[model samples]
Target: MHGSFPRLDIGPLSEYREDHFMIARFSDYVHEHQSLVFPHRHSFYHLVLFTEGSGRHTIDFHHFQAEPDQIYFMIPGQVHTWDFEAGMEGYVVNFSDSFFTSFLLQPEYLDTFSFFDQDSSNNVLKISENVRERIGQLFEELLAQNARATHWRDDMVRVLLLQIFLIIEQSDAVDRRKSAAKGKNATVRNFIRLIDKHYDKVRLPGQYADMLNVTPNHLNALCKEHMGMQAGELIRNRIVLEAKRLLINLDLTVSEIAYRLNFNDNSYFTKFFRKETGMTPEDFRKSPAI
Candidate 1:
């Protein structure tokens, strides 16, 4: 018999669990047909191991063809979707930020692994047969401990999860080195993170430079070197992207969105929006594609 797709809520880790980690092995009978794993954000991290079947998976804006022995690590708050065929078998592990902090705070761990990588979707780790066997063993052990209600089950699970993260970290390190040598620099990464955190509050290069503790000229130079765009252009692009997302996804009025984005006045916001986007926010919202 088939089982329902489990939501597996464990409540907050501060309540009962000593550490915020949960592991479960999925059987082939369970199929989430209509759910589509809708675009949503999470406060915890996810590590999905696809042991069998094929599908189309999208993380952030990039898409991938899913196959057996492929692993996807989705950080918190990233939008993702997956559609798998019937009889898919794998494991879905979720852990909170505090769970990782216990291990990630170590100097060696921080040096070896990047907590966030901008190109993670393009460089997913391919699990080998040996690694798959080890992971399966870990999952079985975790399930057994949970079933027996072991006194130290949470701690044991934390160790196992750390092992898995170490394996993942190795793969991420390889990808990171390649990306660092060929792609954006640390400044761009920081810039992107800042934008993600405060895009709705600030949209000026001077403001960003002040936050980064650098002169606007220096920030612009760094941006041009890594992203091949001026700092002001990047800020505008981010604002426009947020504006588009709001226009397409929410029922909020354009004026409300402009105010939410901290525009000084509605008229200026509309003018700026039209200058950055080819069409006005209203027209963009009414377009059939939206």
Candidate 2:
């Protein structure tokens, strides 16, 4: 609860400090990097596949119970921590944001996966028992390839990781395919990326619409159709989520947080937070995490 005003951004484990990629058994990773048990952020993309575990993990204040065959993906900069029973074992992979960009000509290729969309609720998935063994085999291959330095090692690792992503994507392909059929999947994803990049300064749907080269109404329609919410609501939700994340850092005063979020003043920020979450900033800060 108390440390830096902003949470710490942990780099790779000490053993692989200079490398931009790492793979390990979950138990080994946890044992080697105990600091992760505390509230912190990561500077690299992270994913974990659990073969055995019980308890829960929190990503950006959202709680998810730990379970076998359940996998989770996290992009850089999200807060994460976990509490699990003894004997938790699985596979974990950490790679730089550029891990796939250079390999694939399409820079946004990874974005097409719904789990990497920066929404905490969508980042966790349960693996159907049918494909569980295949997924485990892929992880085994990733681990083995990572251990060797012979012949295109990095490329081999990248391909294996993509295979894993493709398998998981198939599980949710129906919903994603439906969104793609709507013919606005790319546009909506762009809008979301823009919001993530500019939410602090841009507050209006019109601003985002202008950036996206579409009318505000068109933008709203796309969001409503694909995301089940108006464009403005999406922006507000991102802002509020950031607020909640910042409030978790006990070292930061409310006024400091307000400034960080670019609110005009402390009072206005409090009002905005209260309006969106139905709780004052202080109240939320003091509340116990689920």
Candidate 3:
């Protein structure tokens, strides 16, 4: 889809481009501006805690129900939009990658949080009201520190932010364990990983099947069992997702995009895209995100 909202570099939060962190409550954000209706991408990571709300939040075109005590994290460059009921209450934390990467020798300092990875795209996590009490206190403290002018405000704020992340990590560990035990789709998972790494060069399901050491039929069966789709559909879906992203975010033409995505013939690319998405490349580029 095309961008209706102003991109971050041009939006009201453009000041953040020069700063490392900024925290705002939902009430103040709404009071300052009427609504955040436009779908936009940000230059920094976002941690939006929904303490009170009932509506929807869309990240990377994946829609999630907004409920009380739920938190949504957005990685940099991920596109999102929200439509929450009026009078909603929450806190929004914006920080740059540099903020967390300051003290790290290696990437593990921030990489430990896998949800922050763009691939997972940092979806929603529902927190219990009891846990929110503790976490909410920390946020309130952060808000308090954010408001008062102090010499060590930025450093102190960074410390508090890391604490919140640790809290989330501890609270979500059990959920991760349950997730690991549930579904158990290693084949599909590895297939997706491989697809991300090699989708540009490999188009055949047999190639992926060979890499995964399984017959194409077995791979298809596992994929259908977990994702409700077969091998070819998953690969095509990834290609279409990338195509849509490039078409929407870049100024490239259909032929350029086709070639950039490794299609040798533009017409064949259009037919393949049409067969998978029911729309030609031009039509799909003109369309909004589905």
Question: What TM-score, over all chains together, does every model reach?
Answer: 0.67, 0.92, 0.69
lDDT of each: 0.63, 0.83, 0.73
Report the backbone clash tally of model 1.
0
- lDDT per residue for candidate 2 within 47-161, as digits (tens), equals 9998987878999888999998889999877888888889899999988877777799989788777778567877888887777888999999999999898889999999999
Candidate 3, residues 1-290: lDDT per residue as tens digits?
A: 35554332227676765687888897787677564566667878887888886887787767788887888777666677777788788998888868756655653355455346444334578875557888898899999998889998877887888787767766743357433322266677778778867887898999999999999999999888766778898888888767765665445678888898899889988998899879887786566543
Instruction: Tell me the spans in candidate 3 whose CA falls farther than 4 Å from its real position.
Output: 1-10, 33-35, 119-122, 172-174, 177-240, 247-265, 268-289
Q: Give the TM-score of candidate 1.
A: 0.67
- List candidate 1 stretches off by more than 4 Å: 1-19, 27-36, 106-115, 118-120, 128-152, 172-189, 223-256, 263-290
lDDT of 1 by residue, 1-290 (tens): 01221222223323323446766664422342245454344556766777878887766546778787787776655555566666677877666657656544552232234434434444366775656777667767766766666777767777776677666555433365444523336666667678777888877888888888889999899888766789888778777766665554444667788888889887888898889877788777565333
Q: Provide the global lDDT of candidate 3 against the true structure.
A: 0.73
lDDT for model 1, please.
0.63
Ten-residue stretch with the least lDDT total in model 3: 174-183
Query: Which candidate order results from sorting by lDDT in descending order?
Result: 2, 3, 1
RMSD after CA superposition, every candidate: 6.3, 2.5, 5.6
The number of the candidate with the highest TM-score is 2
Best by lDDT: 2
Clashes of each: 0, 0, 0
